[model samples]
Target chain A: MSVSVSANEVADAPQEARERTILGLTADAWLRILMPLAIGVIALGGWEWAVRANGVPSYILPGPIEVGQTLVRDWHTLSISLWITLQITFAALFVAALLGLALAVLFAQSRVIELSLFPYAVILQVTPVVAIAPLIIIWVDDIRIALLICAWIVAFFPILSNTTLGLNSADHNLQDLFRLYRASRWQVLMRLRLPTAMPYFLGGLRISGGLALIGAIVAEFVAGTGGRASGLAYRILESGYNLQIPRMFAALVLISLTGIAIFLAMTLVSHLALRHWHESAMKERR
Target chain B: MLAGVKAGPPVVTLDGVVKRYANGTLAVQGVDMAIGQGDFVSLLGPSGCGKSTVLRMVAGLIAPTAGRIGMAAGGEATGDVGFVFQEPTLMPWSNTLKNVMLPLRLAGMNRGEAADRAAAALAEVGLKGFEKAYPRALSGGMKMRVSIARALVTKPRLLLMDEPFAALDEITRHRLNNDLLTLWQAERFTAIFVTHSVFESVYLSRRIVVMAARPGRVVEDIEVNAAYPRGEVFRTSAEYAAHCREVSDALHRAMGE
Candidate 1:
């Protein structure tokens, strides 16, 4: 009787999961891609209608068409600002990864070092970057370096904590096997601890990517009136001063898109790295 | 080679070994035994019988609280000791071949030679075509085979197994038992296996040491006079059932005590 019940379940499971598709895409897949886009279009259409009907001025809330026209007209200026912001974000993220990984390894080796220094990292994370931007800019002659420092500060802690946890989480039995074989310290770290830490490090990377972008933009906002060469935040400030609100909206749109792209790239990297072995990343079998 | 006529001296000896945890619990007490080279011995008991504790002591993984635990100088000089835990306990990131090569690599052997030996070990465990498969992709039985291959890759003279097949189903357990006997005959390594199953111990070991719980210690030792290369025919024979009954009865009596 149990055998026949299991057979019935086995036969029925795939039919329910085999959802129909529109064109080449499954129903669920197409809905996921199209639903967000449809909502965005309808919301914008409503805003445009309401603005024209009520004769609301562009200074208050620019319609979607005006924002689009401003984006195309100011493409050169806006694209340059976008590139500058992205450059700082990527630089800060790279430095954070290298420093966080090195410090985590050191901490794994010695409790004394971790205990003495880890509190400072926590303090840096809790204190807002805006509060320290002016002091950093005054100390550092190069505005780019100041921006990178602020971004690196925001992005370094997650990688440190997560990688430390992963390193310490190596299976106890495997460690015993290594001891039985008389493995060297370097061998145990490279073969067991590092691989155990990869998935966690990637998780931290995804979060740090977004945080780095936020740091760069916030620092740029603080340095807007003082620095000569600046990022998109400076453009927003300039547009607000001149009451070119449409151009400000266009700059905001570009910034959001860039943040989304960074996040998606990090997600792709994490998926590729852990897809084979880690349970968190493996694909579910039916 | 001479059908188990005391092939060599005792490879490992425990003289009144005692283990008391830091939390003030006495896990094992006053256990004394000697295992000869190439002999198959089973430490059989119920749960909390400290069978696994004894196995761990033999592997030199934990210190005995009192008395002397000694290894033959010949075996210690070669540094060849293999261990298989209840779980497979493999590194998830590495493939089967790399996992098997870990011990040799730690011993300062170069990658080329280690890879050759690792592949040979995988073949010996019937995992030849799966050298590149990751641990997550393999089934439970296959993963256990890889763990066994890793343990055997260094040609260890002493192998300590702690209920290695306890998690497997009955069919797979029987097949692995047969395969393990083959490996034992071919390699002639001293095996000290820990198990809670009476029939399993009687079928697998030449001598079964029955243990009791509540401050665990050995109570009895029963010898199986079965011949070498015992197979399915013996498993179905009356003699095998009689041996199993005897061991089971001993185990029941120990538990009652």
Candidate 2:
């Protein structure tokens, strides 16, 4: 037994430890990089060709090129508005994450609480943010605070629902061990349940990121938060009202870019935190 | 004091301990047994014989439906009850040392000193160098070793193991069996192991309590005169084979196989 164990020790050394490295570059890699660019170029070229061929004025169906030019022209105005939108989106998301996790823990601890409150959460989720946003504006005197609350209501439920499920999903056996150790409820929660809930929480976070952006955009429409603390939504609405079709297209382009950027940022953060071996993060490495 | 009185003057006793699930399936019944301090015992039976349930009952992880359980002077927190599960059950996120340190950490020991004791416990289980590795990174046997380390890390007066070797390969099992015997000798912990293998039970235990299923109860108690620090030679000896056969026959008879 001693000899065998010694041999295992010898074998245990990290000799050719079989790293999970991707071996060779394939057409897939190039496909990933070029496919989007190709699609974007093709779509924009088609739009340009259609607008020019039809002899449509810029006010009606302006080309992507015209929007880009408008974007360049209105960079300073767009930047301030983008910054405001970004701030509200992030702040609401932060509050939503904290509240979501807290509510999850609360729900996980008591079946009675979970059963009683889960329906209300579902209702909040299904209720249109557009409907609630105006109500929030009417109730709250401060426009900034009201918009934040509206964004929060829109974005918070997904996070709360998903994270509650995550916290409840801890391994039964591990929980038994913790109980046997006479670990305090807090210790068990922090040391075992929270870490176990991480991947799920991150999953919720990814989903909620897009929801947060949508919430901010939707809230802006309802808040009519213009002239002061105006966002990309206000820019789009202003351009639409003024019949600056090219500028409206430009604002639309900016909004889309922000959404894409938020999605990528979230994906990157998830990858960095859980990329070690989590299944969700494996897509990019492959 | 009341627990001691209810237990009726035994170091450890299970009186008519029956466990019935909500669906009315009885896991254990009328299991009366007593263990003195410094005894090495094994609950030997076929799978689903409720042997694991018995161990869990003793460990206070599961309550027996119809039994009076009594622990010795130290009480429930005896601070001496250590349980090693069938699966390693090491927290996947924790490294080997941290996994072993779990109980001590739970006991409110300072982190630095707890790590120190945890390191020594790991060394005692022959897992000296793999302290930094996570349970996911370790082999099955290595993970089991970490469990053993965690079990012994507290220097518990009693150790409860449920089929600790069932998941390992034979080579690893044999090594763990030897290592376990050595640990028992050095620590002198009152060890109660649950196993389906009569050979394994006969090999390590001083007394083997054979159990039968479908309302599990101990039907036989066989004494093994195996000496301390039992090594490989004992495993291959005539005495060892005789003990194995007796326990195996008893188990077969208990199972009605």
In candidate 1, residue A202 scores what lDDT? Answer: 92
lDDT of 2: 0.81
Which is the leading candidate under lDDT? 1
TM-score to native of every candidate shown: 0.93, 0.90
lDDT of 2 by residue, B192-221 (tens): 898888788888888899999877778999
Segments in model 2 whose C-alpha atoms lie over 4 Å from true places: A1-31, A45-56, A275-286, B1-10
User: What would the per-residue lDDT of candidate 2 be over residues A1-286, giving only the tens digit for each residue?
Assistant: 1222445633543332333433454566666778999998998899899999999999878988888999999988988888888888888888999999999999888899999998998898898989888888899998778878877887788788778877877788788888888888899889988877878888888788888888888899877666845998898889888999988888788888888898888888878876543556554431
**Candidate 1: clashing pairs of residues:** none
How many collisions per candidate?
0, 0
Q: State interface RMSD in Å for all models.
A: 9.9, 4.2
Q: CA lDDT of B24 in candidate 1?
A: 82
The DockQ-based CAPRI class assigned to model 1 is acceptable
